[model samples]
Target: MPSASTRPVAIKIDDATRDRVKRLAEARHRTPHWLMRQAIEEYVDREEKREAFRQDTLKAWNEYQETGLHGTADEVEAWLASWGTDDESPAPEWHK
Candidate 1:
């Protein structure tokens, strides 16, 4: 019996796409269901990360607009370049 937490969900795909999935699944020794599940899971994970990044960017933009305080592009680039180096420096100070 399937686990209580697991339930079936149906999705319709064109015949061509369904055939392609079956072929790929056969080659990879996986079920069509597994392939679709993996695709959805990875897609969700990627989209979630993208959404988070977008939100963070918007927040940073709003904060900059409100405070008018920010580090110079060159300062930020230099700090980024120093990453993983022995002399990694602290982040630049924000200034008005």
Candidate 2:
């Protein structure tokens, strides 16, 4: 969703860490820098999910206050846990 910017980055990592990253890159048929970028992208995605969930929870509480009803985090978790569909069953042993 944003324009891409490219620039060279330099860092000094411990020998062991550098070696491990090089080996991982070889195994994946990519350069160590590419693997590093991939790791950074995954980290950013996880952080975004955590922040969004927190904001959503706060919004839900505000709506609840307007309705003069309140629900605890545990209560919401329990309600979500109870929701399931019979047709969405796990695969049978034979399928495995």
Candidate 3:
């Protein structure tokens, strides 16, 4: 992340929450600004990952719809169950 060309954004908070944030910041020995910035960054990171997963799910669904090809739930479960052992099974093949 670049510190240059950064802008500050202001948000309104309730007095109670503001006080709580202030106390928490004091206890953590960090400024409120740093705390909020860290929180926003973490939230954005988590939301981005969630969005990517959603996109992958949609793509998978669309492909399945178009080709009418997919593995059965039982097959997927069996494949997943074989995760790390002496005789791990191969992945279930997709079929129409």
Superposed model 3: Cα runs more than 4 Å off: 1-4
TM-score of each: 0.91, 0.58, 0.89
For model 1, residues 30-90, the per-residue Cα lDDT tens digits are 9999999988888988999999999999999999999999999999999999999999999
| Residue 92 error, candidate 3, Å | 0.5
TM-score of 2: 0.58
Q: Global lDDT of each model?
A: 0.94, 0.76, 0.92
lDDT of 1 at 52: 100
Better of 1 and 3 by TM-score: 1
Worst 10 residues of 1 by lDDT: 1-10
lDDT of model number 2: 0.76
How far off is residue 14 in model 3, in Å? 1.7
Worst 10 residues of 2 by lDDT: 87-96
| Candidate 2 lDDT for residue 48 | 100
Indicate which candidate wins on lDDT: 1
lDDT of 3 by residue, 3-91 (tens): 66889899999999999989999999999998888888889989999999999999999999999999999999998898897779999
Q: Rank by lDDT, descending? A: 1, 3, 2
**CA shift of 17, model 1, Å:** 0.7
